[model samples]
Target: MTITIQQQFSINLNALLDEAGVPASGFGRSKHVATSMDVGVATAGKWLSGKQIPEYDRLERMKEWLGCSFDDLLGRTEARGGRIPARAENVLLNMVGTRSATRISICPDEPASIRSDGVYALPIEGDVMSPYVVDGDMVCFMPAMSAHTDGVYVIHVAERYIVRRVNLTTRGTVKLIAENARYEAEEVDLAEEVKRRNGVRIVGVVCARILVNR
Candidate 1:
């Protein structure tokens, strides 16, 4: 069976803490750890319980505090392939041209940085998201079927695919925002949009960007 992220983190963290002279029972002494990371004890507890995974920033703090190396915490090191084109002849096409390949570096043992695994590389098709991303930029993202947090996401609307920053509003609507100020932001009722014509669909959340040809 594939080792789960929770299992991996729990085992590694417990081992690392033990090496650092902290027993399993010490996991609950989250106040000290949280204070070091500048977060709340509750958040630290969540990390210990594997209920929540920290981003790279917090992961760095954990590594430094525990005096553990990345491989020590992750259980392994080295780059792993992410995705490739299905066709054999078009393999080259998948890496360049109007359609290009996205090189991925994945480490499954990690619980932090969804950017670490399950990613997709999509090409930028327009200048709406310019300044941050322009045409020909390859965006690395995690596929998300719905919006739950504020972040950059690939959206499908009017039969066209576009990238935008999606934010949740108190009014129970989502705002599709463009980085280029010239383009105006659009708000939609997700439920209603699903029922209407030429509506909105969230493709994925952008995690990283690989820019090329400016």
Candidate 2:
């Protein structure tokens, strides 16, 4: 059966709080849920008990607290080749057109600056990148005209877009490395077809990942 965003959120929130070891007691539950969102403590209490659907503003606040993109938080699911929300697609498009310097950010506690300028909420479609990115992580990107010496990047091979690390050789050979030890890195010449295909585009280099960890 199809589930509404509220239902999905309630399920996910309960799961996250439980995993975080937050007790389901009245004060603990209210405080936990409220901290995750901007809702009032009383409202959170009501939400935890399913007394009512949260208002729109509260939901948006919850999205921010959970760090999931607006779409995923809204429980928009896709099966097979179904279309994703237009707004989500627009966010991806905007990321593509944004400038390079505007696309990167440093990760939490990392001295090195990370990329965040062009973050696309890609709905992962395959398990080729299992265990690292998982199936639902919204991978953000920073744009790069060429591969870095050693860093993960979004590369397009054929018409398929994949996320992998790029290892550039001094002689100009590029290797696509998958973090999952199961996948072997593919080495290719610098001027290969994958580098020039019309569909081959580097969405961006991963900057930071925001997932709902309760």
Number of the top candidate by lDDT?
Answer: 1
List per-prediction Cα lDDT, in the order shown.
0.58, 0.50
lDDT tens digits, residue span 69-165, model 2: 5554444344213332222222233232335442333222221222433334344445454323445554555555566545556665565567876
lDDT score, candidate 1? 0.58
TM-score of each: 0.46, 0.42
In model 2, residue pairs whose N, Cα or C atoms come closer than 3 Å (at least 3 residues apart or on different chains), thus clashing, are: 103-116, 103-117, 104-115, 104-116, 105-114, 105-115, 106-114, 142-205
Q: What is the lDDT, from 0 to 100, of the residue 103 in candidate 2?
A: 33
In terms of TM-score, the best-performing candidate is 1
Error of 2 at 81 (Å): 30
